[model samples]
Target: MKLNYSVYLVTDREMAGECNLADIVVAAVSGGVSCVQIREKNLPTRQFVEEARGLVEHLRPLGIPLIVNDRVDVALACDADGVHLGQNDMHIKDARSLLGGQKIIGISAESLADARRAELEGADYIGISPVFATATKTDIAKPLGLGGVRIIRDNVQLPLVGIGGISAANAADVIQHGADGVAVVSAIIAAESPEASARELLQQVTSAKRIV
Candidate 1:
């Protein structure tokens, strides 16, 4: 799986539902979001598949890749640009086998070992953090800060996205810690203006830390 690291935006289904995922996504793209991930954890598989495809179709012309969270089946059915899998979801090898080599495959990791394992298994990139505790996920990982990022930057060769509790104000800190990009849900969704929030985050998270 090959993906160019850019602004990767993850979605919170509950919050997205309140304001309309399609609308926010469209607006976010217009506001300069380069990629989008549809992460609805509670929906029935079939229903989620349908929704993902709808999003893919809508974002296709705009050129932003749509990634389905955790479900490769849903991703395949939707012909999504890729899939983002958490630690417990599926092995990277098996995901590659199923999705083949061209589609994007992202793994969620917190520790250096996990990031290294993902890279060794052929993951395109890895999401690293809960740089801070986040309301987006129920079982959030402990905060990593710059120390956690340096560990992965030191040990793994894959691009990393610093996720969890990231907002425009703290985005510079994450990138400074070695994240290739920053991924957010609540920080953007909960903002008064989603588009402006996303744009600010994008503007803030510039320049990846030089991994030594």
Candidate 2:
């Protein structure tokens, strides 16, 4: 796992073709993204693998860790830096068995208990949030708000990233509560210029990171 990136960006398929996914990722990297997760849900496994392979090639040379969302098979096929698993995706142990040591694995945590469990199970890092509600999830967890963010900060020691509803406007508050970084999608992909948008958010995240 590279762990070279501090700003983590999750790609939504809506940005495909239109946004030049690879270019946006590179721009994000230039803007200070530490990691990129190629998250294209609903694509057939073969289609997903094809896309993941292209991303692996694009990111590998740049030295950025590319994480595939939900599918360990595709991750292995592309030799991705890691895989990010949701609560119901794949058990951490199984993923660990497959990826073996030296590969990164990230699990999502919505509560303190989930965060603790992820640590105990050998996850490399954890994604914690809906620090505020997000329209992304069909059935989302209760908003952690800042209090929940603080609880995770006090209870866990691993690298932490806050996801869901993160934007430049309130990103400072999220990292202020104790997230190592913020994972974003819409804020960059939806902007008029992804690279410029990412640079702005990266500035905010870096400033927030310094104070935290």
Measured by TM-score, the strongest candidate is 2
Where is model 2 poorest over a 10-residue stretch in terms of lDDT?
1-10
lDDT of 2: 0.85
TM-scores of the candidates in the order shown = 0.92, 0.95
Instruction: Rate residue 128 of model 1 by lDDT.
Output: 89
For candidate 1, give the lDDT of residue 95: 84
**Per-residue lDDT tens digits of candidate 2, residues 1-212?**
53743578999877544767777777777777778999987889998998888888888888888999999999999899899998999999999999999889999998999999999999999999788888766577899998899899999998889988888898888889998888888887676777787777788888987887
lDDT of 1 by residue, 33-105 (tens): 7788898878888889888988898889977889888998898899998899989998878888998888999
Q: What's the lDDT for residue 28 in model 2?
A: 73
Candidate 1 displacement at residue 131 in angstroms = 1.3
* Runs with alpha carbons beyond 4 Å of true place in candidate 1: 1-4, 207-212
TM-score of 2: 0.95
Residue 168 lDDT (model 2)? 87
